[model samples]
Target: MQHSVQLTYDQNHSLSWGKFVGSVLFAFFGAQIISGLFIGLPFMIYTAGLSDKKTIALYSSLGNTGGTLLQLLILLLFIFKYEPIKKLLLPVLNFQALQKVRTYIYLFLFFGLSIAIHIFIISKLFPHATQEQDLALNLENLNQYKILLILGSAIFVPIFEELIFRGIILQFFQQRFPFWIAAIGSSFIFGIAHIYSLGVMVGAFMMGMFMAVLCKKTNSIIPAMLFHMMNNTLAFLS
Candidate 1:
């Protein structure tokens, strides 16, 4: 009787943990989408008369920033309320890890070169598949809001994304599953979250996998965050 009761208690505990993790994931994604629409709709309506590329880009950046801020706020609430989450996040924010500047520099160079080569080869094989025109159009308009664009893309976006995807989601999965299963599962969702063109989706998936690997290797999300920030900053400048 005692054995059966203990087993039942264990199952109940596991189920509760699963539900908490699921709630966290759902809350982050749901709040992000809703906040984006809430913030973006007003900007879009207000700028309807202006109708310039730069104005639109500025508003879009602002909307994105607002959405990211909402996610950050939500994550902060979870971190404070959950001891496990706080434990998971605290190490990633260690100042000692930030001092490994050279390691991050190498990581950025290696991944940047690898991705560039992959894109080049893919472009050669599929000449009609380039999304550069669309990317260029969007990025070019951000020239007027250069500083805001840089801060939003390089700093805020990376911090928000890495914390949610790698720090929370991936770690949560890793606790319940094998490493590869957790990594691939999180990376796939990360790609879907981008909602880009097919080629960009593939790129996002690959980038997500790479970042997941980096997080696993370092046992901290800070390295992945730094890489993401550099990657975004370069893409914005390019």
Candidate 2:
């Protein structure tokens, strides 16, 4: 027999804030640590440090790709017992989600905003070198693992990221807060997860807000996922 558990919006309002922050932080770091151990255990036995480019690329690709997988798994676990989500996500995932005019509108607007962000903010935020230089160096280092990196960044990470940030966290906040508040709050954590690079952090924040709104507007995560996929793909190629 199947039973559906329905949680009220205000029933657990007191701890919502703490639960909000705790869930995001736990999932973010938990993914990193779990994936690190999963992929790093092998390198731990052989190399003290990754001096070899191939080793570094292999390590990065496997670790990152594996990390995204872990994140998805973790997010799934969080939503597993909640039976209501399937309905919100079930309606859209068709050709219309990708083909709808509004989807393109959101993508175009965010694409323009992303460029402005790179020009106005990211260029100045680069501490030691330019973002382009950083990317070029990373590409060079990836060597044989470049494809894996592309797959992780362009596909897996977007799905996992959107699932966690906009899908789970944003919805959690919405249960207790206003829509805008929920979007911004979840977007903030989305940005923080990409704290490794200032430019990426800034860009992620903006994109997160955009995707959150899109998710709300479309009533599905599919559009956000497509937008995220394109954004990461362009970023990796650039």
Candidate 3:
């Protein structure tokens, strides 16, 4: 009877984990698909010769931002409504007192680390990759669509990404597995999601790992989100 009870409990736990994982995956992918469609709508309209390329790109970027924000709103609703997800994410959302000096130190450290890894990835690891070149070209060409780029990259992307990866996925994995396993696994997924080139992937992985560590240390996703925003802002400026 005891053995049977234990087995039943384990089965229930596994089912719960499976359900949570499924919900998260659905939210993530569904948002992306929906956002892609929304973005494509503007392009299609532009192709109908109603708007210029820059106007279409700007509208597409706005659509992308709206989709991302909608995804976050849906995920936030889920997080609040679901007991399991709430329990997992409560620590991340809860306010905590932080030392000003220490906070600045950590911010600087993470920012510097992100820059160093990006430089190393571009210069040594994937020297032939045009990741930096592509970034520069994009920046140079952002005369009219600068607002769209800033809003999409510096604001929406960081918040949504941190909530999804650090707040939900990493915390869920940490519950089921060891810390390092969870961190690396989530970081790998994060890297793959941003896979434009080898250098970009490596940089993203490193940044993800760093953000994971920050989330773990602070027991809050706020810091990670801020760090991500800072990183994105730097990239935008550069």
Candidate 4:
């Protein structure tokens, strides 16, 4: 009877594992769709008729912002639709790893350190050439429409990206894999998605892992969101 009971438990665990993996894939694919749309639409507009670099940039920024919003919407929907799975996610979301005040300081320090590393990497690699063009310049050219770019960059991108990567994808991994595996694996995927440069990739991947860990440590998505927001704000300023 004990052996039979063990077999039943194992079967149920296996089923749960499959479901978790499926959910993670769904979230990943959804983010990709939104992300692609964001990057592609502006290029389409530029190819079709828009001759102005500024106009293209503004449009691209809008796409980036909108894509993020869609990602957040997906996260909410997934959480609502899969309450049982979300329960499994809660522990990862509410990690008790950093209960000390020093941890908060360390978190921000890490954020700053990562940014410095990216800047240095960009300097070494591109040397006199800017890798990713400044979206702000493009938006500025649009004059009236620039508000859209600002809002999208300063708010939308951070919120949406964090929710998709940290809230959904990381948690999805955590439910099935060990903590380190989930964090690193998701971070690697997140880093690769950016396609900026080697330095940028390393910086982004590191940030991704940190954000994932933060989400787990805090047991709340807000911390990661805030961190991402600050990072984006800095990017906009730079």
Would you list the rank order by TM-score, best first? 3, 1, 2, 4
1 versus 3: better TM-score goes to: 3
Off by over 4 Å in 2: 1-9, 12-22, 44-52, 81-96, 124-140
| Residues 15-103, model 1: lDDT tens digits | 34665566566556665666666775776677787767667778766765665666667666767676756665676655465567655
lDDT of 1 at 200: 55
User: For residues 4-97, what per-residue lDDT tens digits would candidate 2 score against the true structure?
Assistant: 8887654435334555566656556766677667665654544457588667667766766666676677666655543444332334334466
At residue 152, give the lDDT of candidate 3: 72
The number of the candidate with the highest TM-score is 3
**Candidate 1 lDDT for residue 36:** 63
Predicted structure with the largest lDDT when compared to the true one: 3
Write candidate 3's Cα lDDT for 132-197 as tens digits. Answer: 635634544443566767777788879888888998889878877899999999899898877667
Give the runs in model 1 whose Cα sits over 4 Å from its true position.
1-21, 24-27, 51-57, 82-84, 91-95, 100-106, 109-113, 120-140
Give the lDDT of residue 132 in candidate 1.
55
* N/CA/C clash count, model 3: 0
Q: What TM-score, computed on C-alpha atoms, does each candidate reach?
A: 0.76, 0.73, 0.82, 0.69
